[model samples]
Target: MAHQSTHETVDARRIEVIAPNFKRRLSGVTTTIVQLVPAQRADGLEIAALGPGLPRHLPKLRYRDLWRLRRPPQARAQRVWHARRNTEMVGGLVLRDVLRMPLKLVFTSASQRHHQPFSRWLISRMDYVVSTSRKTAGYLERPSTVILHGIDLARFRPPGEKFAAKRAVGLDPNRKIVGCFGRVRRQKGTDLFVSALVEPLRANPDWIAIVAGRTTEKHTGYAAELRARIEGEGLSDRILFVGEHTDIERWYQALDLFIAPQRWEGFGLTPLEAMASGVPVIATNVGAFPELIIEGKTGIVLPDLEPSTMQEAASRLMKDDGMRAAMSSAALAHVAAHFSVAREVAELRAVYDAVSPPAETRAGNAP
Candidate 1:
């Protein structure tokens, strides 16, 4: 697909924060930059993104802009290099340690596992570290600020007419739509989500399920196998694989329940998105699912990763009108109170401030 940046690249001298996307693919790390940069800029931070796959509204910094970073931006001695990936950390090191640019390196880790030696070494070189969740913080080589991710509330919100939204998405307006979104791969537990829905979908004619996400060349076979299973169950029509959508917020509006069925994850965001859209979620006990869900309130966190657990909970919630409605209201309220994008941006800004202080506070030139 063709991508463009409508917002002109910000001048290097004016930027205090330089958020980079080393990987071009639409992964979680890239998604974070896309969502956070505009909000941070709106809050009056001198932030500009670096690298590809970012939206048009986000201010970007080009490859040639690095030369301008030799001197610091206007108000600080050093610019903040915020990296979520190892490659980005390497770039920061090249600019700071090798080329000797006035940059304060910061790395944000979302992984739950202990870091490998090389990663730990790179992380040790950082001026500040941020862990996306408290669970994520536990795996870090050094102390980190636990700043949970938040959604764009204006984009992912409760639709006034839920049934109309389903129809708008070309789904059955009468049926309760249960959706599983994200990349369609085994690690994501797409097969598990499909299996769980089969018995429930067959038993409950009023409900239908949609699997929405990208299926890359490598995962085509895996996705095809999952489709075969759905067809075998004679649920080809009842279970739909609508592929990925740019406007996924509308899919959230059409959902009665959302499921994050990942077997493992690094600080997942789908549950938070669903709740923000006023849709209850049934997520697996993995990643930040436990941290994100308000068990028996906003959503149900499976006690185990078993498909049976997901199946039972999904089936029960689809049938319980009172419970789902109450949870839906509670989910929306919880996100607005705790997980708006503004909150995430503010917390991150705090981290950036500590390392790259204002010009008045600096005693000498940055190292």
Candidate 2:
């Protein structure tokens, strides 16, 4: 389902029209529309607020709070909110009570406490709550499933000419580039990635690490720490921070290998992009890595966060051309078979069918 937001309304509406066609073809059945947009624009439509933490002005079908709210309420209203206490019971009761229709609760990522709480609450309330990672699923107090986010593989495919893309993005075409792309942050393990590079550069001084991401206070501090580490290692010339950019696929195409040594992630989207671009990835085994990188199959998974671990894995992948080629093919095939929209829709359809009410449950509302 399309996530409804002020910025995404147009795209969401477009998908609303297109989704039915997909449902008809994939499930051989008609689909029901459940609006999650807030009350200001909901126009009196019926929507069950998937979690206690409602968006700014959305009408609350039922509210439950699992994640701690980062934003305070503008003006408190006499609204019923699902309390964090005994949320599992409340969710299960609600599932059997209020929302008896087929339902699928999509949890994007857990950046806050509430998102997970809401996700757990809804997992008990619905047929299934789709998480972006196996680690995310592990965090849940209730049953949950994993569905890795897919990329527009068409847009992120290997470029026709590697040098052409590298030049378009203002990079030296001849450099053996090691690219990292994401919103720069410590939790993303930017420091660890930079520390790992220290030894690698001593062996191959010409090799460059191209780090790209937006710099917020949370991330800028981490970037500063990384820069200091690079300078201390006496490899400032080899490490370059490109900041943030919208055109990430081009960066992926230019890279020889992608490095993501994050401490935690819901499901790393950057690794998916790198995989789609057919560039091998070296990522941490924490969180979603096991699900995305199939050890010896798709890409290398580092079991530890040590710089030596990452350096060793990346060095192996870079030197073994046959291994890199095999992993590249496997990466593309894995994404195509499991992460495609077609696969997502099929899994969602099964959940919808399982939740569809029996004749006794539907009564007069039967259609």
**Which model scores highest in lDDT?**
1
Q: How many clashes (backbone N, Cα, C below 3 Å) per candidate?
A: 0, 9
- RMSD list, candidates in order: 3.0, 10.7
State the lDDT at 336 in candidate 2: 74
Give the runs in model 2 whose Cα sits over 4 Å from its true position: 1-123, 356-367
| lDDT of each residue in 57-130, candidate 1, tens digit only | 77999888789999988888799999999999999999999999999999999999988999999999999999
Largest TM-score belongs to which candidate? 1
Q: Which pairs of residues have clashing backbones in candidate 2?
A: 38-58, 39-58, 39-59, 52-63, 52-64, 63-82, 67-113, 67-114, 68-114
lDDT of 2 by residue, 1-367 (tens): 9866522222111111011111212110111111113221233212223332323343323222312122212221111121222343354445335644122223223322334555455545543454556666566666655655555666678878877877888888876678778767877887777877777767765568888887787556667877887888787778888977767778888887788888876456778789888888899886566777788888888878888888888677766779887888888888777665445544543333343432334464657
The clash number for model 1 is 0
